[model samples]
Structure formats: C-alpha cells, structure tokens
Target: MNGDLNERSTGRQRVLVIDDEPAIRETLDTFLSWEGYEVATAESGEAAVKQAKEEQFDLAITDLRMPGMAGDETVAALKRLHPNLPVIVVTGYASDEAAMRCSKEGAIRIVRKPVQLEDLLSLVKAALG
Candidate 1:
C-alpha cells in the first residue's frame, strides 16, 4: 500500500492514525487503507485533536511518545471530545504505568512497537465490533 489513498472506496470504517514518525504514519495509513478502511493521518497530537474534532472517526491509533502532546495527552483530549471513541496505543517505549493509565482512561488496547499487522488487524476488528 502506498500513501495515495484517493483510490479507496468510501463507506468503510474511518480510522485516525497519529504518529510523529513519518514512517509509522505512512505505514499505518497504507496498511489500513489496503484493509478497506478510510484512513486519516496526523503527525502530532495537537493536529490529531483538531482532525478528530473536524471528522468522525470510528477508531484512533496513536503513538505514545510524541514531540509536544504525547499519546496520553492526545487520548485525554479525545476522550473529552468523544467519550466513547475507541483508541489503540502503539508505542516503542512501553511501561506498566502508561498501560494502566491508558486502561483507566479508556483505551481499547496498548500495543508495543514492531507489531505484526495480522495481530493488529484482529485487535482492530475486535475493537470495532
């Protein structure tokens, strides 16, 4: 899958992909788009917040360690905007504290970096269900 998402069909589930890393953002955007999801990418937590407000996303996948706001902060802000929104946290720097906090605040799952697309697809399906 490439970064060109204009060819995708509509009416599928919309997913927001948030990551400061360009590689990760593009990877997820392409993967999700290939899986028949409508994908939107954001490079920062602040940008993600604004995008979330402007669009209706069925799910959000965010990175934990970002430049300014970070995943937790983004999740918190998103919760305030839409309490029932499902979020999945993907991070290289995983910790018990962060996982517990994310669970407490309402993330559907917290996946470590180097995740396999198959496993992630399963989680995404379950979360969306």
Candidate 2:
C-alpha cells in the first residue's frame, strides 16, 4: 500500500494503528503506508500495547472504542511505556467527556470518525514533527 511518497528523504516513521474493525484498520494501514509511514495495526487496545512494547513507533492512531483496554487506557499504557509517545484518538462516538478524558490521558488529538484523510495526515505530520 505504499504510495508515491519518498521514504528515504523523510525517513519512514513507524505508526501504530489500533482498531477493532477490519475496515478501519485497513484504511489507516493503506493510507498511512501510502504516505510513506511504516504502519503496524492491532485489533484491540491490549494487543496495541503489546505491539508497542515490541517495536518503536513515532506515533499512534487508535479507535476510541474497543473491547478491552479502551482507547484512553491504551493511550495511557502507551505513555507509561514511552512517556513522549504521541497519540491520536479516533471515534465514531465523539463526545466532550470522552475527548476530555482522552486528553487528560495524554492523547495529542481526539478526532471524530469519518475523518478526512488529509486532515488525519496533517495531524499526523504535525505530531511527528
């Protein structure tokens, strides 16, 4: 799914994408990889944390809702493992409370579902930068 973007110049930044839905995971993996990011995906928050321990990632994009270890918990766990790791939380059920909670848990951004690819990319770039 790698796109036309050059990885040598920019350096392929590894990105962790966590989502329970196969479609969502595929979408992020394809788009991010196309953008020249080395991407890894997990189907649950628990798996995401486990993956994080195994590999180093520049950034993480995760679904807010999941079966075990919710998005906020996942973000917290990631931070615990890597204090400065940046996280972007995406959810179909965006809410003020959820956003605030995620923010408090160390998420860099909380984006609602149906997020525009460009917008997500921009946020990712900013986070990586």
Candidate 3:
C-alpha cells in the first residue's frame, strides 16, 4: 500500500530523502534508484518523520533547512526512532557550528549541497558499511 512497501518487496536497501525542494528530491531519488537503492522522498522534515515512523530505512539524507522541522530536528527524531539509522545532512554552505552540532547530534556525515554524485555515493557506501 505504501511506497516503501513496494521497495521492500524488491529486497533493496531503502533510503529516505528529506528536502523542501522538489527538484532536489526528485533528482536524488532518481540518482539513488539508479545506483541500486530503494528511495523514498519527503518534502519536509515533518513528512520525513512520519514516513520514518511508518517504515524502516537503512539511511536518511536530509537538507539542513526546511519549512517545518529543520534537518537537525529531523535527525534527532530519526535517531530517537531508529537509533542505529545513519543520517547525512546536506547544507547549502559549510558551517562549522552546524557541523559540530550535527556531529554531536549523531549525524554520520554532513555534506555540502549541490552534492557531487561520486562523493555522495562514496559517503553513502561508507555510512551504510
């Protein structure tokens, strides 16, 4: 009934993408799918949390800023629900303060936006491993 259910039936690793921008979410969903991952997308952190609670995801890639809950809150919620879940935060600009906070908040990686496919894939692989 749910999108994640379809992905699970395929026996693929599931990834949850949380971003406010439609283009970015679609692009990452397509790219991650091409890279052999089962992808689900949320337009805001609130939606992300809802989806995360409904389904199990191996990883979550979320934007630093969004309309409702920010990336930090999203990561916190995800960690609370799925303690072992790996989260990657993507921001438009590099911020030392944010990076430090996210690190302490349990983010596995903080990546800059306009992410290169290769670098993102490598990070994903490393985190998933």
Candidate 4:
C-alpha cells in the first residue's frame, strides 16, 4: 500500500488531524486529501479544540501526547462540543493502560503510531458510519 490513500468514496468526509509533529500532520493531511477527504490539521490540542468549536468534522484523529491540551483532553472537549463526533487517538507509546484510558475518555479507537494507512482509513470509514 506504501501508506498512501488513493481511493475516493462518494461524499467526501471531513477529518481533523491533530498532532505536534509537522511531518505526521502534513503527511496525513496530504494522504487523506488525496483520498478525497476534506482534511484539516492542528498542531496542538488547544488549537484543535478551537477549530472543532468553529467547525464540524466527521472524525478527528489526534495524538495521545502533545504540548497544549493532550489527546485525552482534546477528545473530551470535542465530545462536549459535538457529542456524536467520533475520535481516534494515535500514540507512539502504545500501552494497555493508555488504550483503556482513551476508551474511558470516549475515543472510538486508539491506534499505535507508525500506523498503516489502510488501517487508519478503515477506522475512519467505520467511525464515520
């Protein structure tokens, strides 16, 4: 798959990608864009919260650790703003505890970093549904 998303389904979905790493954010933004998703990127949880408050998104993909608000907080904030919105938490530090915590915080899924693009795309599709 080369970690690239090239297929486009009908009715493009809007996705917000929140991560501190520029490379991760940009890469995801580009890949998802190419996949025909309306993508938005935020470098910090605070910024993500602000953006979510200002706009609507079908799904949100966020890093578990970040400078401003952290993924858990961001997910909570998003839930407050949009209760039905689905969130996916991505983390390099994949642990059972962290995954459980994310689930407790309302994330639809928790994906470990260096993620396969196909897995992510699949999760996004399921979340949107």
Number of the top candidate by TM-score?
3
For residues 1-129, write the lDDT of model 3, one tens digit per residue.
465575478788999999999999999999999999999999998999999888899999999888879888888998999999999999996589878777787899999878998899999989888
Q: 30-113 in candidate 4: lDDT tens per residue?
A: 999998898989999999989877777789999998997878888988889988889999999968887887788899999987
Please report the candidate that would top lDDT against the real structure: 2
My TM-score estimates for the predictions, one after another, are: 0.91, 0.90, 0.91, 0.88
lDDT of 2 by residue, 14-96 (tens): 89999999999999999999998999899999999998877778899999989988998999999999889999999999789
lDDT of 3: 0.89
* All candidates in order of lDDT, best leading: 2, 3, 1, 4
Q: How far is candidate 4 from the true structure (C-alpha RMSD, Å)?
A: 7.1
Per-prediction tally of clashes? 0, 1, 0, 0
Q: How close is candidate 4 to the true structure, as a TM-score?
A: 0.88
In model 2, the clashing pairs are: 3-34
The residue-level lDDT of candidate 2 at 21 comes to 98
- Would you give me the overall lDDT of model 4? 0.87
Worst 10 residues of 2 by lDDT: 1-10
